[model samples]
Target: MEVKKAIIPVAGLGTRFLPATKSMPKEMLPIIDKPVIHFVVEEALASGIDDIIFVTGRSKRSIEDYFDGSPELEMHLKQHKKHDLLEKVQDIASLADIHYIRQKEPKGLGDAILRAEKHVGDEPFAVLLGDDIVVNEQPCTRQLIDIYQKYGRSTIAVKEVPKEKISSYGIIKGKPLDHSLYVLEDIVEKPDVDKAPSNIGAIGRYVFTPEIFNCIKETSSGVGNEIQLTDGIRNLNRSQKVYGYKFNGTRYDTGDKVEYVKAIINFALNNENMKDNILEYLQDVLASKNNA
Candidate 1:
C-alpha cells in the first residue's frame, strides 16, 4: 500500500532552547528564512505524503497558524506587487491536508504517535520527528517508504554515528542483507558506548505498519518516565520482521543549540542570495580569530 499519511510529533517542551522557546515553539525557529517545521512538511510532501497529522500541545497555535492562510498578509503582499513572496505564502497554506491533535500531556514519542491512530486508521504510515531535518536528493522519509514497499514490513532510517555518541541514540544491531540494508536483530535505547550493540543509530524517520500502534500500547514507560518510541519499535520487531536502511543524507538535529547554529550557517552558505556575502563574512571572522 502507498504511504499517503504522516504523523509528526511536535509536542516536546523545548527546554534546551529556554527563553527563546518559552513563548514560541522550537519547531517554529528559523534555519535561514524558513522555520524548521516548514522543511519537515516540505519533506513529507515531496515524499508523497498528502495527509499530515501533527500531535501538538499547548502554545503550538503558531504552528497551525503558520500553515494556515493569512488573508490580510496575502492582500498586503499582492497590493505591493510582491508576486514571488505572495506565491510562497499562498503555497504554504495549501501545502497539504493538515490536521492537528493534542497530546494533552508530555508523553514520549510513542504516545505522541498513538494520538494519530484514529486518523491514520489501519494503513501503514510514516512518522517524521520535527526536530530532525535531513537534506538529500531523495527525501529521507521517501527512502524509508521505498524500503517498506520492498520488504512489506516496518522500516526505520539509520545512520552511523561516532561510537562516543552512541549513548545519545538508539543503537541497532542488524544482520546485513545488502549494502546499507539490514535485518534488525536488536535495538537498544541510549545504551552506554561500551555496551552499545553497534554504531548504527536510528534517526527520526520511520515507516511502520499499523501493528506498531499495538506494540506501543503494550510498551511501558521507560527512560525519563516517558514511553519511548525505540522501546515500542523493539517490541514490534519481536512479533514481526523489521528492517533498517542506512539512508544517504545529511541530517541536522535542530533541537541542539550547536547543531541548530550549524544548520543555519550551512543552509545560508548554500542559498544563492546569501552564499557570497556569508562566505566573505565567515572568511573575515576566521581571519580575525586567527590573528587574535
Candidate 2:
C-alpha cells in the first residue's frame, strides 16, 4: 500500500540498440557515467518511490531531456566556477516527481504499462524496466517492494535463468513459499525450452496490484503482436495470488549487445573514478591477449 508509484516502461523501439537507438532514447544509453535511465531513476529513488511514471515513446525526447532543468547547463556551470559541477547538474533536476506519457505506437510491454492507467489511479505500482540494470544491495525495486510489503499480493523480480536462457524470459512456475519466495502457479510468455515453466525468469522488476489495470485491459495480443506483460501477468494470476522474489542481485540485460558490453565492464570495474584506471586497462588487455 505504500508503493508511491513507479512504471518506467520507456517505450521500447530500441531494436536492440540500432543506429545508436537511431536518435538516442535507449534510456539514453550509458552506464559508466549514469544513464541507463539513470540507473532506473536511481532504483525508483532508492526505493521509496517518489512517483515517477515515464512510459514514453517516439524517440523519447532524450528521456525528457535527461530529467529536465538544465538552465543553460546551469549558467555554464555558474560561469565556469563549476561548483562541483554545479552540484552535479543541479541534482538531476531534483531527482524525482517526474511524469511523462506518450506511448502512441511501438506497443509491447503491455502497451507500455497501459500508459500509466491515468497516473496509476489505484496505486500499488512500480514497474522499473528500463532494459533492466538491477545491481542490488537491496534495490531491485526494493526487493519487490519488500515482497509487496509483506504479502499483499502481486510481486515479481525473479532470476535463475539458464535452461538455454529459457527462451529469453517470462518463465515462473511457483510453489515454494520462501527460499526466496514464489507463490505463482504459472506464467509462461516466451517459454519453449520444451515448454518451459520453471527456470524462473521474469526480471525487470514489478510490484503491480492496481488489479493490474484490469489485467492489462483483458490481455489479447501476444508475442510481438504486442500487449504482453507476460500476458498481463497471466491475467493477474487468474484473480489474485502472484509472487516471486528470488532477487538479490546483478541483472544488467541493458538490452543486450553482449549485455551492453558487460554493463560497460561492470560499471567500469566498480568506478572509484574508474577503478585503478580500469584495473590497469584490464591488465594491459590481458597481457596483450597472452602474448598473442
Candidate 3:
C-alpha cells in the first residue's frame, strides 16, 4: 500500500529555546524568510503524503495559524498586485489536508505518535520528527517509504554518529543486510559510550506499520520517565522484522542551538539571494577576529 498519510509530533515543550519560545512555538522560529515548520511540511508534501496529522501542545497556537489561511493578508497582497508573494502565502494554507489534536500532556515521542492512531487507521504511515531537518535529493520520509515497500515491514532511518555522542542518541546493533540496510538485532537508547551496542544511531525519520501502536503501548518508560520511541521500536522488533536504512542526506538537528545556527548558515550559503552576501560577511567577520 502507498503511504499517503503522515504523523508529525510537534507537541514538545522546546524548553531548550527558552525565552524566545516563551510566547511562540520553537517550530515557528524563522529559518531565514520561512519558519522551520514550513520546511518540514514541504518535505512531507514532496514525499507524496496528502494527509497530515499534527500532535500539538496547548501553547502551539502559532503552529495552527501558520497553516491556516490569512484572508486579510492575502487580500492585501492581491490588492497590491504582489502576485508571487500572494501565491506563496496561499500555498502554505493549502499545502495538505491537515488535522490536529492535542497531546494534553508531555509524555514522550511514543505517546505523541500513539495519538495519531485514529487518523491513520489500519494503513502504514510515516512519522516525521519536527526538529529533524534533512536536506537530500529525496525526502527522508520518502526514502524510508521506498524501503518499507520493498521489505513489507517497518523501517527506521539510521546514521553513523561518533561513538562519543552515542549516549545522546539511540544506538543500534544489527547485522548488515546490504550496503545501507541493517537487519534487526537490538537498539539501546542512550547507552554510555563504553556500553553502546554500535555507532549506527537511529535518526528521526520512520515508516511504521499499524502494529507499532501496540508495541508502544507495551513499552515502559525509560531515562527521563517518559515513554521513549526507541523502547517501543525495540519491543516491536521482537516479533516482527524491523530494518534500518543509512539514508542519504545531511540531517540538521534544529533542537540544539549550535546546530540550529549551523543549519541557518548552511542554508543561507546555498540560497540564491543570500549566498554571496552571507559568505562575504562571514569571511569579513573571521578576518576581523583574526586581526584583533
Q: Which residue pairs in candidate 1 have backbone atoms (N, alpha carbon, C) closer than 3 angstroms, thus clashing?
A: none
Worst 10 residues of 3 by lDDT: 162-171
Error of 1 at 190 (Å): 1.1
- Candidates in order have lDDT scores of 0.95, 0.86, 0.92
Superposed by TM-score, candidate 3 places the C-alpha of residue 87 at a distance from the truth, in angstroms, of 1.0
lDDT of 1 by residue, 128-231 (tens): 99989999999999999999999899999999998778988989999999889999999999999889999999999999999999999999998888999999
Model 1 residue 182 CA deviation in Å = 1.0
lDDT score of residue 109 within candidate 1: 93
TM-score of 2: 0.34
- Which parts of model 1 have CA positions greater than 4 angstroms off? none
Q: Which residue pairs clash within candidate 3?
A: none
Q: What is the lDDT of residue 291 in candidate 1?
A: 100
lDDT of 1: 0.95
* Tens digit per residue, CA lDDT, model 2, 1-292: 7998898888788888898888887778887667888888888899899989898887788888878888898999899898998888789988888989988998788888888898889878889888788886778888788888888888988889878888988998999876989899989888789988688888888898898888878988888688889888888899889898888888888888998889899788887888898889899999999999
Which candidate's lDDT is highest?
A: 1
